[model samples]
Target: MALEAIKNQETLAVLGKKFDVSPIVISKWKLELLDKLPGIFDRTGSASDESETVDTEKLYAQIGGAESGE
Candidate 1:
């Protein structure tokens, strides 16, 4: 059921209904599964896109010297 939920990208509540578990239980299971997913795959680790940053080298080259704080 966890596998099905992950595979189908369905909500935990949806999977919970199918498996006859409470949504909160399913939510916890989903959290655990997500926590392990990166390790399980090995090839794809998690990364964030929220806070953008620039490489120091690229910043210096592109923006040039003191103004860019390189």
Candidate 2:
């Protein structure tokens, strides 16, 4: 709703009044939404590709198998 209001050329002060929030807050929200808008339809799938799977059991076994040099 705030985004829509912004798009309609409403002043930041007016939007702030309507939403009962500071103009700075509305401005920050608008900026954040704009910054992230492109990721919503990203076709390269980079977001999912960056994730790594971890094996906790393998890690535990390695830790338990290690001998203390003391």
Each model's TM-score, in the order given?
0.42, 0.53
Tell me the lDDT of model 1 at 40: 62
- List ranges where model 1 is wrong by over 4 Å: 7-9, 41-70
Q: Provide C-alpha RMSD values for all models, in order.
A: 17.8, 16.9
lDDT by residue for model 1 (1-70), tens: 5566667677766776666665555565567788878766454444554244757796344334323331
Backbone N/Cα/C clashes per model: 0, 0
Put down candidate 2 lDDT per residue, 3-61, tens digits, no spaces: 75559688877776676556665676678788878776765666567555768897455
lDDT of 1 at 46: 48
RMSD of 1: 17.8
lDDT (C-alpha) at residue 27 in model 2: 74
For TM-score, the strongest prediction is 2
Model 2 regions more than 4 Å off: 43-70
